[model samples]
Target chain A: MADRAAVPQAPELTARRRSGLPRAASPAVVLAMLAIATLAAVVLFMTLDLRGNLGYVLPRRAVKVAAMLLVAVAVGLSTLMFQTVTANRILTPSIMGFDSLYLFIQTALVFAVGGSTLATAPVVGKFAAEVLLMVLFSGLLYRWLFTGGARSLHLMLLVGIVLGTLFRGGSSLLQRLMDPSEYIILQDLFFASFNQVDPALLWASAAVVGAIAAAAWRLRHTLDVLALGRDTAVNLGVDHRRVVSWVLLMCSVLVAVSTALVGPVTFFGLLVVSLGYQLCREYSHRWLLPIVGLLGAVALIGGQLVLEQVFGFDTALSIIIEFAGGILFLFLLLKGSLK
Target chain B: MIRLSGVCKSYGTARVVDQVSAEIPSEGVTSIIGPNGAGKSTLLSLISRLQPMDAGSVAVGGLDVAATGSRELARTMAILRQENHLTMRLKVRDLVAFGRFPHSGGRPTAEDRGHIEYALEQLDLLTLADRFVDELSGGQRQRAFIAMVLAQDTGYLLLDEPLNNLDMKHSVEMMRLLRRLADELGKTVVVVIHDINFASCYSDTILAMRGGRLLHQGTPGQIMQPEVLREVYDIDIRIEEIDGNRIGVYFA
Candidate 1:
């Protein structure tokens, strides 16, 4: 009742003018265009070189693009689905402490066994270990809460935030006590950068992201119902507990994979999903999910290209995105559009 | 019949609905009325399975609400709570189309379109079908939500304070529509209403609750007395028969 927009009178004319502007610009069309735009960005990134050393540059660029795309899909889809289940727009899956947990795991690994052990460990093995620990903690906790005690979603959200603070504090304390050389390794790993995605971990991240996307696709309709808020969803006969539990578990895995692949871009999901909402009118995930994924990919690929070619490695892509995304976040809060 | 057997719900030390055991007949309109905090809305929520009970069970059409699958229960009953809000920018038509989700699973069939049209027409909202739900006036939005529930076309409807936004004329019209829904469509409606005159004029049965317990459940003729009204509302209410309806005058 409070958030009603002051719609213009006689929307008929505005709709007619809009129709003229885009004869074939439905939400599906918008999503397809975004996909194409991302594809174009990828092509431009790959073949923009005047030297034209295709063999020398294409594989390396392709690997980077693939890693970015995987992380994009993971973050975008997880945050979108999490917002729907929580019935609010102000939150992302990062609130579940997965990002801080990622940091904590990295710090604990370094603190317990030292930096050389982690550096010496196979990339796949270390990635697998980090992802496995997060998945187990999140999945088991969700299962116990949803199936065993079956508490309220409000309670779960509060618990998640508190746990996030605890993890962050724990990691910070560990960071301060660590050896200076070990601290460097931890800092390098904790900072999110699209430039440093490991080639070895790319395949595993892709597989995990693919599995998550498929699961999300199957539950797309149910997810739309969930966006109606808990009471209405229950009124429409949704198995609220079961659906929320599964979605939370999936969000954990997605967040873990994305953070492990590209460190932690806390606001990338917010940027993509907000842009996705602005770009499309449809509420159905069929349009929204793809649009957000494509937008994320485009943003990362384009931002990286500009950073490389224009800035000449002056800064990390994550900083620019976080800065812009953080401003957008503040604007949305002030605009009271978070719901 | 909608039956509540020993149903209970509580928050902290206060019981909002305590061991509510009653059978609501599967015909006509039934009004549950009492002062604020009298468990009227909570009872409706329990019957609709919108809230889990701390103890006991509610059964509708002989199926236990706790045991029935959500999809199956949705086919049998629909509930509309007060204070409905949407985070999505949905037009009236799109919002009403969601009523058919339990049947069509988000892909509207031709028959679903028919139901949508019928609902829109019933709410006199056909002209405003394309308007965004958030753009409408309070009453219009209320009507749109009612139309969505009507589009579900379930055998039973449980509504909590549906008249919260309506004007005097619209309130009468809305009550008449519910009467027609019950008399013509053979649906059972349980409404938590505030105005006693509307209840007396429209409902076939009345359930008066007080202090989280059922104080009285009987036909309007049997339960609309000043004594029963005084007991339920904790105030002296004078009953006057006007236009063949037992109108309770509690304003004084």
Candidate 2:
């Protein structure tokens, strides 16, 4: 029996090899390539032009790189988890109103308490409050939708889109009514920028993202099972509802960290995750999460470098990413690959 | 043995599986048969704990399914639903390797690999082991899913419409394989099958359900009568003896 089983696999293996299609690169090789690229981008971004005082230029560059890397990890990990939980490649935490919620909170605070007082508030406290609010809102939504039983993915997506539109509309209305000076401050918060990231807020974001990353690493295997869909995962002994709830909670926290740190990034996560899926052949989260993280780092650091060096800061990195990501979204929709 | 007492399930105002109570004995092939909307699949889901009961309880191998941990229940009973759709790309070997998750927790040991190879051989899937599951034909994909459940290596197996997409040759082969697993390995196999003739020929016990209740439960000789099948299906089905096996003729 063993000999017969062994015999058939060999011919098929040889047949596949003889075929003209190029074999996929192994996950390890892909990971190594991405890691090297990310490192090169970081090095180039940090030391490409080293004129002026070393102390002033070096520390500022370090802070900017740190902020970019943090956002990359935060956005990449969160988007991957969100796609797994929702079982759709097209969905991301940002699309589900997470960034818009952050925008709404900023707008609301400016509308209610005046922009000067908000800016004067202690940075850590304000960051903590924003993080807490985002987490609580996501927690309540996940608990309500998933705890009782399995809810349709369509229903969840619908709710997310509706809420996202509501937040965006509410923020715009507030901005329309606010004082011109306050609106200017609010405008700065609307566009995602790695510059001007508070050093203290960066530390807090790192701690939160680090703790969540550690937790998510332990669930790497379970996440693979989850990608099989709810019934199959449950049959394999996964507490489907509980695991999904926890994953959503982790995604919300990661999104909160990234959004709070660098303002709202609408399609950066979508772009990173989509590219990661195309480049990596493996389905396991153990490989996928890191590949995605490295991919995000490379995209951000590399894009920022190109924008600064090649374009001379003519445009923001987020605009280019969102443009490409938005086109891909439309392509995926037209292709009907949402499955 | 799997026992259900006063198990009930409802969707809104519609009762899907109402007060279903039956004991499925171990060490044989048992088949559940009924017309559409008869709750055959729903009853199987309730027993597997894939769907929670609206009212009563289910016990599998003397363990309360609700109270036991999901992993423990998984080691004892494995179920396959009617439709299995995967959104990600996965090789056939990788899909089957998931069956070992209950035991190996995603890290397959040597023994787990042995079982996986055995299942692949049993399902005649070794030739397609390297192929992507999404690229396979419908019948081949169905067999791949069956191979996955077989690799689970549980004491009890529950399958809903396992032969839905299979051709006649593969369907008979599948039934014969299930019979051999029950007779030779002492596995308790339960299937929700649509073809009454296959159920009658292969199953030691036949359960006929109608309108969310078990209308009849007996051996093939007892439940294959035209009257019993008529009451369950709301149509006349003639039973014929062929090769000493009861076969139902429902066409025409």
Candidate 3:
């Protein structure tokens, strides 16, 4: 201790200089760039080769763009928050069987009621019921897993995978036993598509996603602390269990909304979040959240434009996005950067 | 000051920390030393409120740890575990800045910056503040973590095995730093240490445990004898007086 006192002190300015190492672009700049690109994609998608009845074509395109934006925000925010709470970069809500559970709920409803009644059911009532069920299920899962003794990541992954398989198996079994016509309707519901979003359902989902995003925004700083892992977050005075429960609840709602709107885009969130981390290179959620949203928007709308204009609507946007995202997932796994 | 009364913890059928009651006075270096699985770390965790006790009460500065809000307890005490595995990339300065979260709520004020700089200087990490934590060696990483806890600016500092992975020289430096913190800042520094010699040399009070119970608690001179140490560790350790500090020779 005495020897420490004898060590000569360097000037404070030099200490500051030492911290000024070269770094990636500032988070604000990256966010601006992403926002501009997203805007460009939206504009190009809306206006490319505008023709025919102005009111008809414009309203159709506007609805498609709105659906894309809502799903982008929902998926991007949910995936980022899920990864933060779980403290694993490779895991997403979809990978943990969230969408499968959603599909299970939808399939069970259709099986219980004939396809005609299910299709005739009030859209608002069905949407609310689905979102509530997803939220409740996730809340229960988080409470059981996180509140007790320490839980290993492997155990979590295994449980998620098992539950996902169970749900998928149950859905397929029900589908196999259903009427052939009903089975066709259920099959259409399973694949992700943006072509047939009901305008009323779109508005309700937007409202839900908007309210949740506002709540999540207030928790940005807490999210950053959460990314540090549970023990450290607890040491830093965070109510680890309560905050995690709330975040997980929000994630479930977001996933439900997005899956209800565009069906299950398994790898889309992974791609958006991975690209956000690579571009921003910062751990703070204040910037990462927006960057992820913009990136998701860009990928969705831009890919839609390419598919419509170049491929002449020959391929679905979700399939292409999932294909790219799945490859990135494999790349990340092979590179051993899960940490 | 930390007071424990009837503190107990167990995993399934095995009681890791039996009904252990003791008082650690404020503002000194107190080292809890014992053999492996002797419940030293468990006791520390109970006091820090890191783990819920099966049965017991811990009061720091007269505030009941269990009854108090986590944020209030955080303002009064800070604990560091042995292994800290971070999942994200963070610079040394950024990691240390997180210590201020209890006070700043993720937004650093000018006073917080002052605290951070003071902590960085005390840990001799000013030059390495820009480096990523993953880029650091084991000793450097340990120092960075200590610096983060130091920046928390709490009156009580609790560390479990602070010298677990350090070399001889780094371990000595860490012990000295703890000593200086206790002496200069008047902080109540409680450390669960494995090295009996370091405990005997640096700690003002030494608490010895064996078999999930605290066997002895006293000054270095009172607790450094061969019989007391043998009882605590189940090994014979000869105590030598070196420059008025009690040194233990345990090597056969």
Tens digit of lDDT per residue, candidate 2, span A1-339?
Answer: 998889879978887875622226778888988899999999998999889999899989998999999999999999999888777788788888888887887788889989988889998898888778877877886556655555566676677799899999999999999999999887877778888888898888889989998888999999999888788888899988889889988998888888878887788898999888887787889889999999999999999999999999999888999898889888876787654
Which is superior by DockQ, 1 or 3? 1
Clashing pairs for predicted structure model 1, backbone only: none
RMSD of 3: 8.3
Question: What DockQ does model 2 achieve?
Answer: 0.65
Of the true interface contacts, each candidate retains a share of 0.67, 0.76, 0.61
Task: Give the TM-score of chain A, superposed on the true chain A, for all candidates in the order listed.
Answer: 0.85, 0.89, 0.90
Docking class of 2: medium
User: What does candidate 3's lDDT look like per residue over A206-318, in tens digits?
Assistant: 99999999998899989998888777787888888789889889998999999999899999999999888887777799988898898899989988899999999898888
lDDT of 2 by residue, B50-108 (tens): 98889999999999999999999889999999988788889999999999999999999
Residues B1-252, model 1: lDDT tens digits: 898899999977999998899999987999999889999988998898888899999999888999999989998999999978887778899889888988888888999999999999988899999999999999999999999898898999989988989999889988999999999999999999999889999999999998899989999998889888878887888888888888888777
Q: What local distance difference test score does each model get?
A: 0.85, 0.89, 0.89
Strongest candidate by DockQ: 2
**Number of clashes in every candidate structure?**
0, 0, 0
The residue ranges of model 2 lying beyond 4 angstroms of the native Cα positions read: A1-23, A109-114, A146-156, A176-182
User: What TM-score did chain B of candidate 2 earn?
Assistant: 0.99
**DockQ of every predicted complex:** 0.60, 0.65, 0.54
